[model samples]
Target: MSDDVYTGGCGCGAVRYQAEGRPVAQLHCQCTHCRMRSGTGHASYLVFAGTEAVTLTGAVRVWSLKGDSGTDKHHAFCPVCGIPLYVTFAASPGITAIHPGSMDAPERFAPGFVTYGLRGLDWDRLDAGLTVFDAGPTG
Candidate 1:
């Protein structure tokens, strides 16, 4: 794997993806949806800035829901093993965010911030040095 390339797949290897270039953002999200889906207090992600640099293979099932901001958030998972892989946002058409745990090299994930801080659980303490946001960051 190249330094600038990231490769990963579902637990069953039924779905796979390759993303080229550096990630735009890396975060740990504590939203209700993330917590429930991840079966944890938070879910970590690497957000690539453009979908054009990403390639996906194999079959996946997607489900969408309105986010807190009222934007449609589509989650893609492997239909065979039911492992969540990535997500696309209606508001950010070109962006793709993948779960760090799904990466072939999860050690590469370096979260820079925490989203939905208000929803974070005290027991699920994260690095205090990381910036925390009450909601998603906006330009």
Candidate 2:
């Protein structure tokens, strides 16, 4: 496999995905939506600049919700195991965000910063060296 290629799937192995090239960003988010979806204090994500390089297989179910920016965010998950996979944004049609835990090599997740820092829980401490933002980073 090429070093630039990343592959992963759901818990039941029913849904799978492959993403090519380096991710645009890696981050940990403490937003209420992220925490609730992950069932944790935060959720890690690998953000890709475009979905053109991404290929998905198997059946997926999507749920749409209004994001903090008032844009629609569509979250895709496996219908079998109900594992959250990737997300698409109405405002940023070219971007895609994947759950780090769903990566075949989860260790590849190297978070560079934290988002929604103000919402972060005291018990869910993050790395002290990472830059944190009260909201999503702007390009």
Candidate 3:
């Protein structure tokens, strides 16, 4: 794992987090579940391996739901600011999706892929060179 550490928090500073090592994947998910989760056209996700790589200093209100793949999705967000933080997929304990917008250096996130491209809104232009998958690609 790369020794690139990222520290960030919610908008209200009520939820702080630290992620060590490089992210497994940086991608844009345009699936329906992501749209609803992010309250937008799509969601930006930075995936990391294992919860051990992430440290949280504040409490969060969790919301449990199922993704389009029928896998359990647990989202932790700041109750005070109502800003989404990360998501844990029950199907893959080793992987967690952290919101790049919550990062101290949001500019550091460079999406290498685009998932659920078929469902992506036409108006939301994405990088044409990125590796893309239709209806999903998890990893």
Candidate 4:
């Protein structure tokens, strides 16, 4: 991992976080749930280790939802700002999916891949060079 540290927070500054080392991967997810949650063409995320890597400040509200795979996914966001920050899967505790847009400098990490390609909108086109996955790579 690169030595760079990435810092980010919620829109209202109610929640802040700093992650050391470069992200393992950045993703653009076009899944239906992501579209609804982000209210955009796709949701951009940065993946990182869950343990001893993400240092967070302030309180965040969590909401659990059943994923397409029939597993529970806990999404954490700032209660004050209501900005989605991170997501954790019940089946995988070692990884965290962070919304890149919540970061202080989202442009520092461009999405490296696109997921749930089958669900992508017909009008949107992600970068052609990035790898495309039909579903979540976790499964």
TM-score of each: 0.96, 0.95, 0.93, 0.91
Q: Order of candidates by lDDT, top first?
A: 1, 2, 3, 4
How do the candidates rank by TM-score, highest first? 1, 2, 3, 4
The CA lDDT at 54 in model 4 is 78
Best by lDDT: 1
Model 4 TM-score relative to the real fold: 0.91
**lDDT, candidates in the order shown:** 0.91, 0.88, 0.87, 0.83
The clash numbers for all candidates, in the given order, read 0, 0, 0, 0
lDDT tens per residue, model 2, 1-139: 7778889989999999999889988999988888888888998889887758678989899999987656788999999999999988989899889998999999989999998888899999999999999977641
How far is 88's C-alpha from truth in model 3 (Å)?
0.6
Best by TM-score: 1
Which clashing pairs does model 1 show?
Answer: none
**Cα error, candidate 1, residue 39 (Å):** 1.0
Error of 3 at 121 (Å): 1.2
lDDT of 4 by residue, 43-107 (tens): 88888875756789999999998876678889999999798998887887877888888878787
Q: How many backbone clashes can be found in candidate 4? A: 0
In model 1, which regions exceed 4 Å deviation? none
Off by over 4 Å in 4: 1-3
Where does model 2 exceed 4 Å of error? none
